[model samples]
Target: MNVCDYRKLSISMSYYLQLFRNNAGVGRTGTYIVLDAMLKQIQAKGVVNVFGFLLHIRNQRNFLVQTEEQYIFIHDALVEAIMSGETNLRMEQIQELKKSNSYLEQQYKNIIQFQAKDIHISAAMKQVNSIKNRGAIFPVNSYRVHLTPKPGEEGSDYINGTWLHGFRRLKDFIVTQHPMHHTVKDFWQMIWDHNVQTIVMLSSLDEINFAQFWPADDTTSIDSDSYRMRFLSKCNKSDYVTRDFIIQSTQHDYELSVKMLHYPSWPNLANANTIYDFIVDVHERASDYRNGPIVIVDR
Candidate 1:
């Protein structure tokens, strides 16, 4: 492979390694510790087959390698290694092998109906606004937090939010779309009502579709009737934008420290590997606040 291809493969390898642990229900730290020890053992002994490696790994530490895709990932790694100028396989042979593997992958996906789901997603279509095509939150996994509006309001108090459960039954986050101009007040109301400590805004304010809910200047603050949120500070990373916020209740004396981790270069899915560090940082920051759920604005 060329230099660019080699670099891409290296990035993919790292991403797949992380996914391997996730598939086996291992935490980030545990994955690193176990993989480090396993690699050392492999070096001491000799290279082994996929099953043999997995067996040794399971023996060394308790893990669950769930799903065929995880196993296939390991197989792909072996295939990649075999084709990395390490083996004497001809170009034609390598191409044929890759074609066979692709066929098998497609067959596996087709058997499982991986692309076609016979479930109804249009049941809540009535609640979806004109601007948002896929805005309906499934009632089963939706957040029940509704704004207690005063007498004269016409619309329902339901905000477009959903409770996102974290690993090991930890209910850690509430994710919602970017608030429209009409729903800005409702957004703040939801934050105050839910006692949300961290607010992760994942959209760029400069985007035409996105509304500038908060003031652009860090010196300025935005205030709702019940709450006051100010831009405390910001740190710009290579892959994402991080901002600290101080939200205080105008009615009550309580306050909250919010961290907004915004990744603007999304939808451009090439950033999947590039944003790994940013994602880790977000996780680490959110883990600090154990009392309240973090609000993730996905736009």
Candidate 2:
């Protein structure tokens, strides 16, 4: 997650540990005395190796007590160090490290945010140029597989077999292939062998903009044309896209299109006055050579 969340967790853990230690009523000297007794007892039992003694203690209940006592001693010593102001040096060093880390994190975030904005702007400009030159804009690859309803067949089957299947498969692939899998063992070797981003899948839309995917309409049939329309509307409402439309009259039966001429990053364009402005401008420009007015409907 985020830095704020991590900081909160760290603070909570520290508070809980301190509370536990205070309730235990054990001091550094008392804990060490218990450990020393346990060590002597283990040695008297002919366990000459310290490592074996430690392991034996770890495996046995009485030994476990000694181990815990040792831990308490270390904890108490650390607290004593802090109370005596000796840990101030370490704390100062930590503060310096944290400040450096925060600066680096902010810089990294700024660079990525700038890159995201630039990518959006460049894509929008490309769409505008394509429109002006009467060239076709490349369609985004659908994460869904296409399926036509069989004669007298219900639409639900098509939805489950194609759209739902595709979506689930893609999600599963992403989770399994995500770069952070520790079991990967040789990530650098894999990276050198294959030219690909460490994380092959984009972060979930919900993670980036929860409002975009929240309030999902589960009542609607997945196979219905309106299902995808509703999904698009939610995404657009969160300002993820300028607008989205589906053309049913086309020979392809359905064509999903996103208006990229006006993006969220740049709001000064005269042609992009509103979410519907880009469509209106395109309609006006192609009026003489085109069909009827395209209906814009709410999901």
Candidate 3:
């Protein structure tokens, strides 16, 4: 197929449909490939870690599809090529990576690249240090997570979290900073309200940056707003610790069980095989909450 067949554009798209799947040019074709890789990774494991996907595609060329704008060019061209009834290439499989080189060329104004200046102007965002990770990291207002305020806790719709688009099977994932002492109540509220079943705590429970959000001992219970958590059991693993909890709402006659997997240590890429096995464990444990958005906490 000729590289010039990308003139036609279509709308019905993949996980990228909400992000980018239109416009003209070859664009960053690697995005489609990376997204495809992401989908397969998630489909097989029931979830995905960005770092894992990055490492999987490291040796492959052109996997850096950063922005949504990059999705359309290559995706459209691939669609057009397949729609044109090209019999020579495996269009269904997206086997034509070389033909997309030309469409990948693009440039943008410096103003669009950096939003640091824009974030400095917002009052709430500037004062986010109180709620977030001490303002060590700033979030885009457009992408920030807004928790629902409890009954009388007006202006409680703030958390240092953001929703990210997930691949094929999964719709969205919430990423937030580690729950601070003051914000632990808010964190539990978010989990209870949002119906989060599986929480992947990537950060270790170190004293400095990360803190333990759940009950420290098996006999004690922790209360946050209307929710109360009693430690059920702890399962020790090689790279992580799986803790189960029985959470009950003090207000209503409702109780929800939550499973948290905390990584005490991480295996490097050198242990790719081990990581894949770990993915399977996470997949099985998270099956109960696969329908809802998985909450991920980082630094």
Q: Evaluated with TM-score, which candidate comes out highest? A: 3
Q: Give the alpha carbon lDDT tens digit for every residue of 53-139 in model 2.
A: 445554543434333434543344333222232112355576576668766576465445422223222332353223211122221
Question: What lDDT does candidate 2 reach at residue 276?
Answer: 64
User: Over the stretch 1-299, how does candidate 3's per-residue lDDT look in tens digits?
Assistant: 22322232232344244344453323345554555554445446755454455455655644455454453334443433334322344556455544565432221222233344353324235454445545556555545666766577545777777667677444367888888878887777778777778888777677765778788877888786678978899988766678888889888999988888876564233566656766777678666467567788776
Q: How many residue pairs collide in each prediction?
A: 0, 0, 3
TM-score of each: 0.52, 0.17, 0.59
Give the higher-lDDT candidate: 1 or 2. 1
Stretches of model 2 off by over 4 angstroms after superposition: 1-51, 58-91, 94-232, 235-299
Displacement of the residue 180 alpha carbon in candidate 2, Å: 18
Per-residue error (Å), model 2, residue 280? 30
The full ranking of all candidates by TM-score, starting with the best, is 3, 1, 2
| CA RMSD of each candidate after superposition | 13.8, 21.0, 14.6
lDDT of each: 0.59, 0.30, 0.61
Candidate 1 lDDT over residue span 106-125, tens digit each:
54554454221112222223
